[model samples]
Target: MNPRPTPSPFSPIAIGPLTLKNRFIKSATNEGMSAQGVPSKQLVKLHSALVAGGTAMTTVAYCAVSSDGRTLPNQLTFTQSSLPHFKALTDGVHQAGGLASAQITHGGCFTFIRERSTKRPLSASGGFNKIGLMSGMFLKQAMTEADMQQVVREFAQGARLARQAGFDAVEIHMGHGYLLSQFISPMYNKRRDQYGGSLENRLRFPRQVLRAVLDAVGKDMAVICKYSVTEGVRAGNSAEDGAQIARMLEEEGAHLLVLSAGMNAESITTMFGSSFPKENRVQQKNKIIALAMAIQRRKEPTVEFRELYLLEHARKVRAAVKMPLAYLGGAKSLASIEKIMAEGFDLVAMGRVLLAENDYVNKLESGASRDSICTACNRCVAMMYTPGGTSCVLGQPGDAVLNSQQAASR
Candidate 1:
């Protein structure tokens, strides 16, 4: 018998009970399109454009499980009052013929906005809260058993809210030095409790949280996870550790795994290659934090942008798990997309490329373009804090106008 040919990147594929139209998914890159935890029209328009442009699914990034989980004052928080906004956002994406996934996460001890929470942010262990320094929250408290249970409940509730809001899937954010990542990384999690110490122990709380999320929404919506393959810092979770984490997620009934790397607090450049612009550095509001960031910039090794930058780390994870896997990071061209598919990745999750050209997918399918024009200049990284939200500095004219209007309104 003749062998069947490999499926094309544009072919349909199933993730859990959900089947996407194509293999291209828009990865979650924080879009600061929410004001006071409510989704804006811009947020809906952005995903609608991606789907209209041929993306199979577009992720609604950083939807915090609770008000206290927000990383910024403008970040989305899943709640009954916000359901209509989220529903509208999802309705727009569906109308454009695409699936919508919500990336649910918590800031934990790494937050600048703390007034919303009744108490200090919770972490795996109590210690200095570097990210909270600018906000005058110099320290974080350890998560008590009660706190852990509450967080787990919050995650489950968030997943339920995502489903109610019309999301086809929920991408649990367990990476980028967020709440779960803190627990997974030895560098940040230092405690003698069952939730700390060895890698297996570190996996406990995260696993409990994952189990709760799956139980809440796995039967109806796909349960995907975006996790770091490496923290990209000293004494952080290594590639090997990440592989084990992937295995655990698979065993816990996760439908898909999105491979990511680096920590927002320590090695963010590793997550998005290249350095921030000098102008962006100068714009930092906190002089003390700005100086510290400048020093850290000098100490950290430069990470140049390259096609399929995280593929090497992803390969280790691919070898470790049998679940469907989505590859994120540095995929910017038809050649790169084909390469990722050939390497056994089930989906190609593009961020900057899509931000640079939302219609790039349609263009590629129509043979109008083969590669994205994005230079990976890291300008969009800074734009996440801007009023208009994260957008390409090179080609998004509409976003430019939005930014201007937002700045003026401010």
Candidate 2:
């Protein structure tokens, strides 16, 4: 007898040599649940739940390639010292029947420079983010001829370590406001050097990272890339700018492309969230904090994110190449995800939605009649990216899994 075919978004996807059980991707989010960059029992417990829920694969957030590349101390950096820990993480996720992937990064200028004092991070430009108000050159290293060569070697070395750790795939981090992204964006990379100036020159570093990662991981391991179309879409960047980046990334042999726009956290307008900082509230005493947030948000005038169809953006990229694609930035509903897949998007990358509901995929598969698992309060974003998890609107007391993970991770 023939077996029944799977549903639209629930269908298996061909990504390199492996096939995912579903087209649902648990997009990378800094789930501060690792113990000293090791797979804490907390993350193990969390990923177990996500895989049981049926996500195609779960990316283990940002695994920094260099210590100076870190944005947060809590980030999982994949190093030789952390191999035993990474081994456990992959084992746990695979046990639950999902492909386990790690995104290796060098945070560059956008890296919160306070994290390291050893070596300065590589960057296309030597500027600081408007969000961070410390006022120093974030890219202290600023990539010399020697620096670029070292970085190319670093990414490949990182990939070698990831393979040893048992990760089924390794995503070369070239998106968001990270080091590679700075190289990809002209607004950030303002130099007359060989690695800067024109688009091809600007793309050199990221392309090198991709080529190296693929060579290191080889034909079997799925090599994915997470890249935003435009670096500062919220800070006056355009869709066309993002589309251009997608084309460039595809040319560099990206097997997968992820598009994320706008800021992950915000200086909240209204407040269901406590960290959302009652927008207009400022005593003379607290004025400094408010002023900082205001400055971060100031250049973001008309930063509108009105229900963007992220897959449509991926479709734009797909139009240029035959690579598999995934879309992130809040795919909240099964119906929406299914629609995207039916229209040829390979996967729907979800971050906050998965954080809110660990059983989300299970709910979708089991025909569970439950309300939407996402709060849309953007609370997880507020929590993970915030100064503290103290202000999560999703932090509904004892039951929220993230808070539990935080407790154990500590």
Candidate 3:
């Protein structure tokens, strides 16, 4: 008998009850296209373009579980009034012959917008909130027993809303220093309670949240969990801790796991690439904040961009867990995607490349291109703050402001 054949990048794969037509998935990236916390036409058009371009599934990034969980006022927060907007977005994706995933998350203490009910953001442990300093939010409050219970319910409800919105899947945001990540990382979680200390303890709240989400939507939709293999900071969880967390998530009933790295507040470049954006338009609004950000930027470690940068870390987790895994970060070329599939990753999740070339997957399958045009300059990162949200600068018109922004970055 012949040995089982290895799956190719274009092969179909299953994640719980859902089977993607291909292994290519659009990794969640904040589009900044929401209209006052509701999905805008731009957001719908963005995913529909990717679906037309041949992505098997596209993820809507950062749908806050609750209003207070939002990082920005424009970010999507699931509410009854916003349901129709989300449904329209998902309906467009479906019409384009693609599956849509909602990345449910909470901003934790990293929020720029404070809720009316609670002026302060909540996290596992209360301390200085560096990410919110520019917004004048200097401190975060620790979550009480009631707060944790409420958040758990919020996550479960968020999943239910995703299903109601016609999303094929719900990717729980368990990484990138979000609320759940705060519970998982020692750097953010300094609590002395059952949800802190050891790895198991730190994982307790995240586990509970995951379990709740699973119970809410596991049978109907694919449940994916995105986690950092490392927090990319000295005081945070390491790659080993990430593997352990993966096991716990699998045990908690996640259908798929996306391995990512870095913390949004500290080591964002580790996840998005080392090329820091040159434009500081957002920071320039306040001279003091600009100076502070400059200092913070200098303190962040420089992680150079390379093909398959996260593969080495992902391989460790792959060997440790038997469940399906999606490899994210620096997967640009056909060679890189093929290499990832060969190494046992069930899916290849691309963010920057998709932004640079929406039809990249189709191009790869048709042998039209082997590599992406994205230089990984990370200019798109700065664009997330713009009214238009995140977009590849390469495809933008040669307008004077864009030209100047590009030149200034150089």
Candidate 4:
């Protein structure tokens, strides 16, 4: 038998012009700490904790390029009013010895548009987001050519704002059936214009956005993209399609590719690990959301726990693209990270594990823990929909009640 390959989590790797001390990144998971479209002290504390805990890079997630693109009322957006807040966030990360990345997105029909826009939410074609619809979003409009151009400009402006705020990287959100992913996924995009129908056409808008971001930032900051390997429906993009998408992103100059799976409507659990506890919903008291969850669970259900769940699919994307790839799934152990490194992935990102144990990276690096202690209970996932922002419920149970109440008040 061949010898086992050595693991290199501590090795330095270049993602564009930024050199990370280690391959571990705290992948973007919205903390819900932003209110009034700016980062709060709580957001600073969250980023500081992760950086202090030994993450080489920490991603501030779900900053909308435009207000109408916000999926949550408290979500951050790139705007003149929010500049100082973002600056404080990146400054804190840099001081803590971790590079900062901002994940910029346009939520499309997935957002609460009435809060920010007079016009209807835009999509490749008009349709309702089941979750949003249940939450009172009743109408959507297909994107006109001018609307698409404006979105591309919005992404570029977001990147420019990220650079001004001192971020080392900008992660363009093209996954999870968000704006760009909605255009890329065949199940959602039903337009017959030059921007839809065929796979290449479906890629057109996303490509434009990617190009605009690259042009805006150039070599001043790294550009990364998150995209799905599968949209997780009967008639969605498959792994082969993912490979093609990866190549397309590399061609358009993505410094790194974050390979994830699942879409918003059907298979959200696949995008993030889910063992959603029922008590969480009861605590939050949102019946419509609970009903939607029930419907989705009955239809697609949460995928069972497995080590490196996306590794096989990510390998397909790796072979297809020449850029550095970051692996995101249920990686909670050094052993899993080693296996991923041995397979030649350039980076490993953790979401739930980090949410559960902020110092997990330090623990693994010090050899103090063999694996993360997170149970994947996903009460934290429930909390995101609540007003508590996000906190691990392992040691503090009352946090659930307090947080849910706060969310209701909001």
**C-alpha RMSD of each candidate structure in angstroms:** 3.2, 5.5, 5.2, 3.6
- TM-score: model 1 vs. ground truth: 0.93
Q: Which sections of candidate 4 miss by over 4 Å?
A: 1-7, 115-118, 127-132, 286-288, 396-410
lDDT of 4 at 270: 74
* lDDT string, candidate 1, 56-132, tens digits: 99999999999889877777899998898888889889999999999999988878775855467788888788767
Residues 325-405, model 4: lDDT tens digits: 999998888889988888778899888898888888888888888788877777776666555577778754223333332
By summed lDDT, which 10 consecutive residues of candidate 1 come out lowest? Answer: 401-410
User: Which pairs in model 1 have colliding backbones?
Assistant: none
Instruction: Give each model's clash number.
Output: 0, 1, 0, 0
lDDT of 3 by residue, 324-371 (tens): 999998989988887887788889999989999999999999999999
Better of 2 and 4 by lDDT: 4
Candidate 4 CA-lDDT value: 0.81
Best of the candidates, lDDT: 1
Off by more than 4 A, model 1: 1-5, 116-118, 283-296, 397-410
TM-scores for all candidates? 0.93, 0.82, 0.92, 0.92
Q: After superposition, how far is residue 403 of candidate 3 from its true place, in Å?
A: 21
* Model 3 ranges off by over 4 Å: 1-4, 280-296, 397-410
**Residue-level lDDT tens digits of model 2 in 286-373:** 3433454555455334333323335445556656555677867546766676656665667788776777776788788788833455
Worst 10 residues of 4 by lDDT: 401-410
